[model samples]
Target: MDGRASFRRIAAVLGVSEQTVAHRYRKLRESGAVRVVGRLDPCYLGHAEEWVLRLRCAPSATLAVAKALAQRSDTYRIQLASGGTEISCHMQTSDQRARDTLLLDKLPATRQVTSIEAHQVLRLFRGGPDGWHTPIASLSPEQVTELTPPPPDPVPLDLDDGDRLLLGELAHDGRTHHAALAASTGWHESTVRRRITHLRASGALYFGVDFDEHLLGYSSHTLLWISVNPAALDAAGAALARSPQIAHAAATTGPTNLMATALCSSADALYEFITTQIGSMPGIQTVQTAPVLRIVKRAALL
Candidate 1:
């Protein structure tokens, strides 16, 4: 993803000014809809090993455990379960040798770990769903909140097939030329522009993103499955969602009551994050760690 490219480089490549690049970047981030994270080679970053841990705990305890593990600096992520037998966490480290000596040997020893599985990812396939341009007849209040240049009256628009495709094209690549999109969609350039304007006003368009993880030298990735006290999940989930490094957090139907995806610069930083930032939160119970050995597909939409 050219997402990792610096502002000056982006300007040079796109033939734009540094100021324009900076301006666009700001709008993207504040909207909570932009993330240009760096990409990294697990082999190069000393995060060569990938492990998945499944934990069995009380149904009410998933979030507590998930949040506990999420605080560890080594924990790159965590996930919650609604009700399941085992909570799962994905973890990655630099090499097999270290994995055996440190993660496999020492990591589990640090917590009330249940079961663990490890696999090597031969390749990664990140896909973009076809729905970007698949126009939805309506926009929810929360989705509307994610948009910028806020709609004057918070109105949702009625979009046809052409409108959805146009919006999808822009969301996929905000830099897509109106003229080119018009040619492919069989609409006039002006019509395309007006349609975009309407969608933008209605908060149906998203053209902001950030994707710079590996390029920034983050050496480790982890996803934790936590079982928390059931009564405490809603509050706990809301708290975890506010952290910047916590890329994504959701409650799943699986065993892991709570799940959190985290990114950090080094193993030590990851450790600190998990212990201090996460563990310190209220209502936490148990924590498990699973490093992302290979990222099948890590990005979300714009």
Candidate 2:
């Protein structure tokens, strides 16, 4: 879904009045049931590297450690997993210096952290700008086509000060009005609009929806760390990306090269997915399942 899409356009696709669509969206946002957030793909940034970190902490210190990590701008989707002894999160670093400062200096200095595993993300098969499709479908194929945005052009982009300010606001609320964005960037409304167009076209900016998954009957969430033969990594990853159970799948540099998040209706469903869908795949050597005990922070900064 395009978070920046106009209410009128959405209403037309859903066969609802524009005012009704706007009202429902406002209520949802105000109730904290849904949010639209702007996100940047670190892969598209020339100097940035993405990594997934798993930290094993003393059981008593897990929440505190996870909360402290959530306060850092580089970390997102922080979760307490493996029965509250492990912390998992995705992090982005602008350069080697930043990476070392965290992985080498800051994290290792923490006494409660018993172990750390940092896996550099090689390729993202799902999630990021591609987004995840829920197993439960709500729209027809035609409606989905009407709502989908055009593919971004992967062109080089240099962010100006004004563009950064504009992005800072959008990072919190992707659907922020153009006038509000202009105020944040100190640019004219027309200029803000044009800059956004350029940013999205260059693949420097994209939007994502944040909502309560449990409200939609998706109660089981777990992270899968699967070790696969190097020769079959690509095939196994592509297959996982196609699975309806997977919310995000990525290839990373580690003993367990394939990592994915599975969202299902129940623990039984997750077990079925692993034993049937994942177990049936070839070249799978070892599988580790970590149930997410709690979400400390979501993908958005706010």
How close is every model to the real structure, measured as TM-score?
0.50, 0.96
Q: List, residue by residue over 1-302, the lDDT tens digit for candidate 1.
A: 23324577666655679999889877866664455321222322233544445555555555566555554433332344324434555555555565576446754664544544443332221111101111123544543334323322335356588975775565345656678889878999999888766654444443434343564466566675567688887776777666655655655444556766666778898899889977987777888776654332223221
* lDDT by candidate, in order shown: 0.53, 0.89
Root-mean-square deviation per candidate: 15.8, 1.4
Candidate 2: C-alpha RMSD after superposition? 1.4
**Which portions of model 1 show Cα errors greater than 4 Å?**
1-157, 208-210, 298-302
**Once model 1 is optimally superposed onto the true structure by TM-score, how far is the C-alpha of residue 238 displaced, in angstroms?**
1.7
lDDT computed for candidate 1: 0.53
